[model samples]
Target chain A: MEEKDLVILCIKGNRSAQSELVGSFAPRLLSLIKRYQPKSLSPEDILQEVFIEIFRDLKAYNPEKGVLYTWMKTIAIRLILKTRRLDQSWLKDKTVPIEYSDAIPDLDQILNKMNTDDIMKLIIALPDGYREVFNLVAVEGCSHEECASLLQIAVGTSRSTLSRARQMLKEQYAQMKIY
Target chain B: MENNRKDWRDRLDQNESPMDMGMFWNSLESKIPVQNPGKKKRRFLFWLLFLLIGSGFIGTIIIFNKPKGKIAGQTEQQKNAGVTEARESSLSPIETQHAADEIPTSDATAVISQNQSSSAATAAGDSVHKALTKYQSENISSVTKTANTSDKKTGNNSNDTQIEETASSGNASPIKEVVSENKQDQVFGIENQNIEKNAMSTAHELAQNSMAAMEYLPTLSGELYRELNWNMGYVPTFDHAPKLNQEKSGWQYWMDLSYGIGMAQHAFKTSDPLTQSYLGNRSKYESTLESRLAVWENRLIHPSGFYVSSGLRYQTHITRFDWSKEEVKIEWKLADGFVQDAQGNQIAIRDSAWQQYREMREIRQHNTISSLDIPLNVGYIIRKKQFSIEIAAGVTANISQYTSGKQLNFQEQPVKWNATEELTYKKSNTGFGASAMFRASWYPTEYLGVFIQPSFHTDFSNRMNSGAGYEHKIDFVNIQAGVAFLLFREGR
Candidate 1:
């Protein structure tokens, strides 16, 4: 079967195609979801849930409008947010807001020091607002205007918030001397 | 079908997960098991029973009301008989009884009108027939004058007749005198059989004309016949169609209730960092929605289409930051069942210890802003082959307000704080907005038009002053791309 046909079959409850589709997209979606939800969930946990949601919403996909990959990616991003939002036990125990700064990383120190987990830790350690803005604008690469539209804030608010989030991250790196 | 799928695709992108089709389907299948045959059969049975009961009740009502159909036919026959009887009779009962009732009435009116000439009475009688003839002639002008006027043009003729008749009725106060004389004449009533015959013929003709007039009036005229205009099909010619004082362009608008994850960055300074703490200063606000409506003129069928709507958007975010550190005494139970210092990595129980103190916070913010906007657009329309382009700029005068709640939780105890503040995040003014739209109209039939319109607009006044404390300066843009089904057009 063609890829589109296989996708259609998988959406219609075909077992083998579904397995293959999950394996194909899981890694990337896992990473993306992880960037948004580092502390509340593990990448593995989010990846499993993303697959489950993708299956549930398969019948809703339409091939005529756009490519399946872009469609699936958008869904993964949204679901990662919705499910993580439900488990808000972390809200009661928040960290302090990092101060803003501007500096460059030391290439040698950074290469040796920071792993993905440490970066995830720093990201999650940001104040809730800064972290969310960072994920949507910087990590997801949405335009400032689009980010504001999604976040229901003024465009300037979105821009300033994103800038502050990036600044805070730089300050954290400087404090940790990872850069 | 295509539109449905497109909408579904958009919603899916906004709400679904990011998994490949294979894994998604498997996960769904595992999570949502297929229904059993027995349950399906039972469901079918229930629906079938519902349908049977509903149809049976409707059938019973239809049967009960069946008798009214026969009554309708009988009433129509009775009406026809009554009209025929009325037309055949030489005189109405009112005229026959007039002689007996007019004795005293004529004593006053006859004495008064005798000074008026007998020929004047004849002239009055002639004028009444003239009025009745005019009523009949215009009433049936469509049936007879078909070559001269179309249906709608000739339809107005009846209104003109009614107006004239009303004018004449106001001028005929003298005729009641003669009628009163005839009423008092008792046995002398049979003296003018010819006159009576003429009058009866006039009445019969009037009845026929009235019935014919009834058939040509529009259905809306039935109520209006008793109310304003007193004639059928008159008011429709002047229905409420407000003409635009100026030229306009085509426009479109949208209000999206979209929820996604985003961050808020704010700074706060504590007097003493070691003593004061910001648990997880992040605030979780949910149920935020935004709404907008706009109208455009000129290029599309509407010159500009006006629309206003509102919707909600949500996002999931986990934000954490450390607050304050405190040094204090600690007590704990150890698995080793030994008493020792807790800080040295060997103690089962200790009176006090020092450790790195940190607090993490996660906040979800939902922002809902209700906005009311009216945009007046001026645009130009350009048609090229099957495509039409309308470029217009508008001024959307907007009034918006926002309310937000922040919940601070320490150890899972909810501390809620609410604040209602106008989001002065965008510039407030007689906001200048503009729209550029490319519309393609495909007319496969004379009465139907299929159109796809893509439009973009931006408010020029983008400065937002949050009173004295916070001010945000930014530009706002609105983009919409959609298709429409236009029913009937002016041109054939």
Candidate 2:
């Protein structure tokens, strides 16, 4: 169905249309939550919360502006960022492992052997500050300045934090010995 | 070897693992608040519709149950009142008697109408009364004047004394001429007594003859024809006479049940030329319906032969086609696999695939579609003493339809494989159409009868669009035979 039609039906509380929306986007949103890997909440629980918020604010949605997936992704990113601020840990700046920084490990070879779950596991091992900064900049492809704004930090810190996060992923990759 | 970092972003964005969609929907559906705006409106409409239909049914029942009393009473009262008014407008017998009794009581000769009996019956009596009134006043004044003069002269006899009393009652003055007339009146008065007896006899006879001849109208207490019961047919027109018979007038009810043989004409079309060709000869009118039945129909008949009827009708449509035996095949396969040991390390391996097959040929597929409907009809009846004929037209709305059979596609067929595996015949509850009917009935008893209604029904179905651009129209004829029970006698 067209997104306009789907949104109209969802607002009218059509069960089939609401189920269709949930079915089409549930796994993608769950993957986004898994990427954040919140230590306190299950990915499914967080995904449920995301859909609740989506339905609660469905009237404000305008299909003409952009597609639903892009809008939903922004909502998930903002919600994860808000959860991180509650811990107040993502605000700290972590030092890049200097000995390893000389060799920014080439991860493209190891990444080829890995599925997204394994890659996520490697990402999860990094410190909270490095992981948040890396997910915002390197994975999500946000500019260093935008990452600093969202994380409430300086551009210099985001740049340094991403390097540390990538270096840590490399060390974890070597330890796994999959390459 | 190095890969573009953007490649990982694309792969991660496409990170979809097949999950149970129903499970996720169920888990999330509860968290979403339902905010349908029409819920309250729909509920209010439901109650309003229910109340309207319920009130209509109850009102119909009460109207039908009311015994047919007023039709006869009201008609009789109106007719009688008209006759009475016409009688009163003219001088009736009792009024003429009252006019006759009003003349001078002491003098029978003053029953003066008999001498002019030909002109003095009822209408002429009014003129005669006026003339006598003048003559009595003149004679009394002359007597009074003569009595006063005779008092001035010699007042001798008792007869003159009575004359003075008549005069004194009028209080007229004495006159000389009145004295001479007093003697003449005394002799005339004696002669008037003899004549009065004969005049009274003749006047009484004349009054009786006129009373019997002209304006003796009858009321309800008088003999008129009796009102007929409901089952009897009404006369179209009757002659105007005193003995005219009145037909009963009121609302009556009849219960009817019928079974009919109906033929359905089926038409089907499609936008897809290929599907059309394949579906060709499949949707043809394979055979007519087995039977159509209608029961518990109540007809409310008006005295003028117009009626409204409503009932539940059930119809069935069956599709049968010739099927040739053909082989149907099913296949299965086992792919190459590696067996794992205790530590989850593969130890055994296979390098090839296995295939299995099963086959059979099945024949003869059929489907039956049955529908229940409520039909409302308005008709006019032509009836005699024992039989009635009615012609009517009306609409039938579908209450429900049920189909209890399956359809299949043949593997070895003339057409190539199609995406749709089965023909989906969808039916809806809102089907409505009109019909024309001609019914004839024979009553064996006063309250029970049998009837045959031959009907032509045309149903236009917008609900037939189960496939792309498919439309169907059905024309059927039903020759229905049934029994009828008459109820609620309009009048007696």
Candidate 3:
């Protein structure tokens, strides 16, 4: 079925539509949570929380305004920012500048391999600020200005944080490669 | 990194997180009750309605069924008036006046009567009057005023009843015993002398009074107890206690079997001109068959033939809407050449009914509603020796209602209609309704009375639609026949 129709069915409390929604979106939502609030709750609890919010906010959900996945992703990101804002450490860019290196393989290249679980572990091992900035810029495609506004920081700080996040990820990738 | 954003998004979209789907669903299912929050509120409302109706019915029965017999604080006066009126009817005014001057005559005369014959019963009845003259001022005055025509018979039965009442009561007045004690020693020979004087005076006054008023008393007093007995039973109507002649005042229960025809009024409120043109008529009656089952209906009657009644009636009403109206059939269907997804699931849905047809139809539809009705009535009875006619008007409440059958569900979302689509009717709150009933009852036996009551009853209600309401009323006239189980308390 069409995603919009599935959303409508979920809004109508259709169990199949609800399960399909959870099944289809769990991996993306879990990846987002790993960048935001990985250690706070289990992966299962985080998905439950996100899906519950999605179903409840279905009434105010306007399918004509945006795609369902974009809307759901926006909601999950907002919820993460709300929890992460309580710890100002996540907003602090403590990492230093680094030079570009060759150890960082393209994530798309690794996904084409048999398994790419080590790349997710490398991202999770990064500091909160770098991971948040990296998720927004490298994964979510938000502009530097939007990332700064969302994380309550300056555009230059957002840009510098993204640079530091990529260099730190490259170091972690090199270490994983050596191991 | 901007170019890598697409690869990262694509990889994340392709990846599937491992989860306990069963546990996650169970957790959500636990919150299903909280999702639909109105169920709890509706249950509370149902219980509250039940409690209110139940308490109201119980309160009606308690208020209307008052205990009967005996006027409080007026017992002493009744006894005095009863004895004095009986006494004055038997003797001449001069003789009653002479006997009453003696405060201790009744005991001696009662002794004399017990030892002698029925002639002595007449003389003892004079003593009964003489003993009462000091207490009953109005009756004594009425007796004295009517003395010129005092040719009524002796009060032997009244004396007997007075003795019976005095003997039965543990709290009888000391004055009766005090009078008896004063003449306790004079019970025999001299009492006979007083008896002779009373008997002679009785005959002389009977002649003089019969010549003036009651001609029948000459023969009655001429023989006393042998000719005249139980005549004091009628003396309660002597204007001293006219309340004694009042009608039977108690509660009665009647079971009514009613058949009624209800004229239906569909006062639809809609901006849809098509619906307004179709359903806004009050043209004819919806053929109705209503069977009314009245239970615990206790009727409280007053001496003036006015009564108040309250009860519960479980009435099943079958109403038919018989008329022909033109209706169009509509269905929602996908247009031709609509695309399907890779999964072969239909990717598009029809937004509105595009496929339609027109048809002429006759709607001879019927619906039944069983309601628990609490009806209150005030009526007057014109009672006869064998039968009675009652006229009553009151308001009624439909406390609990259950409805069945299908009608035109104009309240449906999107106003969709198919040729065979029929929706269940929702029960509505009908406030108080005005009703008038005329009943005629014939009591062939003492404990059972058969009655036929014809009534015009109207029920006012708002037919609910999508949380708004429109006026819909039903007016019916019915005839009911039933047998009433009569429960008459004392003082009838």
Candidate 4:
């Protein structure tokens, strides 16, 4: 059945339709959760929570604004961020200048050489503040202002943090190439 | 680097992981709880129907069981009877007089029946002739004189002799007619007097019945044993006094406005060590200004000394707290950042050379909290002749609260000293409080009284926010003296 029909049936309290909807969206949502999940929480646990909230609030869904996958992914990302308590205080300890380095490798070369798991591991190894900004701005395609509001920080801080995260990723790739 | 960033995004999109749907479905299916929306809606509708039916049944009972007095029924019957009697009395006057004259007499055997009827009819005609004579004497006396002259014209003929014989017969007829008319007039007058006497007797009986019914009527003061006797002068006694009677059992209202000074003690409880240390040894009782206006209703259940008093009271309390002057040292450690020096110049902080600052200053803090509370209470009063003692306990709802103060905080460089901050506790900060008071009042006049009340009040619920890091409850004891004016009473 189509996604719209599945949503209507889900709203009507159809168990099979609800299960189908969950099954169809689970992969993309789990991947998003894996990117933002803190060390303390399991990906499966976060996915379970995300699906519970999605079903609970399904009745309030308006289809005119966006597609189902986009809406569901937004819910997953917000829940993961809230569970980690990623406020502006996360940026307090780490302060670095956004200067370009000669030793940094080209991002295109690194992306071409790296597999999906290697890239995911590199993004995960970033600092809590850098990883959040990089994932939201660089990977999730949110604007710097949007990332600032989501993380409750200034727009300037969000720009500087994204710059610092890119530099750190280039330095990590240089070290991997040396190894 | 910008070109590399654009290429990295494209590469990131190209790497999508294939998902195992069966495994994910099995896990999610186990976690999702089954929902029965129809059953939930039906249950809600059932309760709503039940509530509506219950309220309707209660309304029906109340409407049907209400008191319906007999006063309306008695007045309606009297009105109908009066209307009938008035209609009968309003007939034409001539018809009623003729009816009176035609009443048959029992002496018909002594005289010819036809002669008796003719004589009664002639008597009525003679009365009409006498009325016409009196009316003609006023308006046309000359006409009578002319009739006498005409009699003289016919004097010497047989017609004159015939007139003389007829006149003589009419002379006897006039006397007999006068006697018969007098008897009929006497009978009509007796009937009129009998109708008036019957009406007066009915009126008298109605008045007696009304007075008897009043003896059984319910009194406004709920005095069931008292009887109203019309035969005796009804002086209002204390036992059967009206509800508004100040000397008896009824609702009495008074408005009292009072202002006084009180002392309050603060008790703090907290799990946070920093908040606990911040409020250390601050257990001293502080003075507060208290003002209250209350309208009280005292219902005296009987002529005896017991009464129940309840009312709405509005009170405002102003409490001041002064954290005494103390000297303290402040310290700050800054990492790689820009800091302002005493000369207001920015200096960069490096990892090798960490920036540190210290300052010492004396701090004095003052806080004031104003609160408005509305309390409702019920209590019993013990009264002697002109004095009463009352003990009341009730809950007060704290409706509004405001707290303003000057405190110290640490910003980037130097500690901000004595910052004026308006701190508002949450709406949950004001909760229901309990109070108990003892009042001794003396009534110098029927409408005025003086009283002194000592009251103890404390919040039964946590009136302060737990998220403020420390929980604090305040209690106060106040002794207030004020004059009360009796605004109204249930009965006059």
For this target, which candidate reaches the highest DockQ against the unseen true structure? 2
Residues B195-217 of candidate 3 have per-residue lDDT tens digits of 34433445334323322212122
Instruction: Please give the distance, in angstroms, between residue B105's alpha carbon in candidate 3 and its true position after superposition.
Output: 48
Report interface Cα RMSD per prediction: 17.1, 19.7, 21.0, 17.0
Model 1 misplaced stretches (Cα beyond 4 Å): A1-3, A42-45, A64-66, A83-128, A148-161, A172-179, B1-29, B32-492
**Model 2: fnat (fraction of native contacts):** 0.27
DockQ of 4: 0.10
lDDT of 4 at B123: 30
Predictions: Cα RMSD each: 22.9, 24.6, 22.3, 23.6
Q: Rate the local accuracy (lDDT) of all candidates.
A: 0.37, 0.51, 0.50, 0.50
Question: Which docking category, incorrect, acceptable, medium or high, applies to candidate 3?
Answer: incorrect
The TM-score that candidate 2 achieves is: 0.31
Query: What stretches of model 3 exceed 4 Å from their correct place?
Result: A1-179, B1-248, B253-274, B280-290, B323-360, B406-424, B465-471, B487-491
lDDT of 4 by residue, A1-179 (tens): 87678888987778889878876777667666656653334456457767765675465455776778777777767666654543446677556676433223566567656776677666765677888888888887888877876776788888878888888787676665633
Candidate 2 runs further than 4 Å off: A90-95, A98-105, A108-113, B1-3, B17-20, B35-492
lDDT of 2 by residue, B1-492 (tens): 335566676677667656677777788787575442311222233334335534543464455445556544643453333222422344222223322222122122211112232222222222222222343344423211112223332344644422212112124211111111133232111112222333234434323343221121111101111121111112222132111111544445566666765444555655432233223333443224444554556666666677787877776655433322222222333333334445333333433433221112223334466778788989877565566676778888987665444444343334322222343365654688887776677777767878876666666664454433455555555566888776545543
Q: TM-score for all predictions? A: 0.29, 0.31, 0.33, 0.38
lDDT of 3 at A34: 58
lDDT per residue for candidate 4 within B1-492, as digits (tens), equals: 666666666555444445666776677776553332311212233334334434543454454445334433432332233211322343312122322223233221111112323323223222333333344445432222111212221123322111111111212211111111113222110111122232233323323333221211111001111111111111123333223223566676778876665655556675532233334344233434354545454443445534555556666555544442222222233233344455433354433332221111223334455566666666656554566666677777877655545554322223344565554443346678888766777777766778877677788765565345456676766667888888776543
